[model samples]
Target: MILTDTHTHLYSEAFDKDRDEVIRRAVDNGIERFFIPAIDSTYTQAMMDLESDYPENIFLMAGLHPTHVKEDYKRELKHVEQQLKERKFHAVGEIGIDLYWDKTFLRQQQEAFRLQIQWAKEYRLPIVIHCRESFDEIIEILESEKGDDLFGIFHCFTGNLEQAKTAISYNMKLGIGGVVTFKNGKIDGFLDQIDLRHIVLETDSPYLAPVPYRGKRNESAYLINVLEKLSDVYGRSKEDIAKITTENSKEVFGV
Candidate 1:
């Protein structure tokens, strides 16, 4: 049972107190891979430190998050670019248009998203997107930029079947997480209809914790809650779900 958490901020300040213990618990629970997404340059050092400590288990990504976009976005984008050129990262992500927080930087967010996608293509790496309350907008951008060079995961996907199909058409895999266990999450109703190959598991830790741990701080160990829920949704054994999703993640991150 080699579970892969494709999106988790193991480097988040939320785990500052006992990050190592939290990681050990996840490892004990069979989580072997942890993909860390960048929010901005602010957490860069922490993420680097995390990878340094767990070189085999941790993989890093470089990008400017949508909500983190502001008047100084260009500078941040430059920093992402410089980092990508300087070293290897698994992907260019958790990047996309986020309208849930503030629409003030919508234009900047779109521009940044497109530019990051181009950067991902340039580096021959997959992207990890953070689509929140702007599916239509993100779809429009992906539609325009669609090509052989573009592909990645729609991190923390919580959309409908049609949207899932649309994302797949653009070479994006659906990233399922704790949301699938939510009573009103809605995706659970149609998840089984989607192929497991198009799905990857995640926890989006420190957020979106599954039931039983709902509203509490989420850790990678809680991924078992999601894996259990998915076992029911897909009508497969927990070990099967873990194996298939881990394979799917390798297809995305190439690790």
Candidate 2:
């Protein structure tokens, strides 16, 4: 069974001490494919360090995260462009509207999101989005900016059925993570409605850890919990869920 962590910030400081061990443990347990998302220029060096350490198992994505969109967003975007020109990334990602924290820079966030989406289109690469309490607003931008080439994952998808369908219409795959394992993380009841083709597995590690590890730091090995929960929801075995989601990820990342 091939399992893919389509979205994870292995570059985060949370894993500085045991990052290699965490990845090694996950790989031993069959969580091989890890697609890393870029936050801002702040973590570019850490990301490069991680990719250098694990070149075969890890892939990188470049973009400015929405929450990181501040007064100097233009410079941050320039940094993103600079990195893109210097290296090849699997996608332009972890970019989208994040209105959950503060609504101060909503306009800037939208602008950055649109611009990054345009970059993804230009590079012929998929994108990974981080939508937080801004699905309606995001839909508006996607409707306007999304073209034939715009495609990627809706990282940490917890949206409703209609939202899922709408994102699908925009060629976005739902990045399923630990939320599905939460007692109150309500996507499971309707997840069966979403075909496996539009879904991919992710851990979003050191953040939304699955049940059992809920409230603690998440890791790639804990992806087994997400996969197990998915099997229960889809009425399939863990191996089957792993195979299908891995294939679906390959379809999106083309790896």
Candidate 3:
């Protein structure tokens, strides 16, 4: 089974002690391809270091995360643009509206999201969105930006069937993660209704760990737990789920 963790922050400081071991464990368990998302300018060097260490396994993206948007957002966006212009990236993402942590920068967040989406289209690269408590707001922006040129994965999707259909209408593949294994995670109820082609697997490591490790820090190896839950939800074999989701990820990341 070739599992693709389409969204993971393997460069996070949480794995400073054993990042290599964590990666090795995931790879050993068949989580082969990792699509790394950008948070902001601060983590760029760390992300680059990880890719240099594992060139064959890591695919990097460039963008400023919504939660990270602040008074100096234009500077952050400039960094994102500069990075994208300087090198090749699989996508322009982990970008979108995240009003969960704070709403003070909502306008800045929307602006950052719009600019990044345009950058992705300009580069002909896919985008990975990070929507938190602002689904409606994000959808609103996406509605205006919808077109054949604007399409990517909605990372860590936890919306209803209607919202899922809406996201798909904009050509996005829903990124399912550890939350699908939680008892309160409602996505499990209607995930089967969403076609396998419109789904992609992600770990979102260091956050949203699956059932057994629910409150603990997540790691890429735990993606297997998510794969198992998805198998149960779709009534498909784990191997089959992994294969299809990996393909879905490839379609989004072009890797």
Pairs of residues clashing in candidate 3? none
Full ranking by TM-score: 1, 3, 2
lDDT, candidates in the order shown: 0.95, 0.92, 0.93
Decoy 2 TM-score against native: 0.98
- Which parts of model 1 have CA positions greater than 4 angstroms off? none
Top-lDDT candidate index: 1
On TM-score, the stronger of 1 and 2 is 1
TM-score of decoy 3: 0.99
TM-score of each: 0.99, 0.98, 0.99
As for model 1, its CA RMSD to the true structure in angstroms is 0.6
Give the per-residue lDDT of model 2 (tens digit) for 77-142: 999888788879999988999999999999999999999888888888898999999999999988
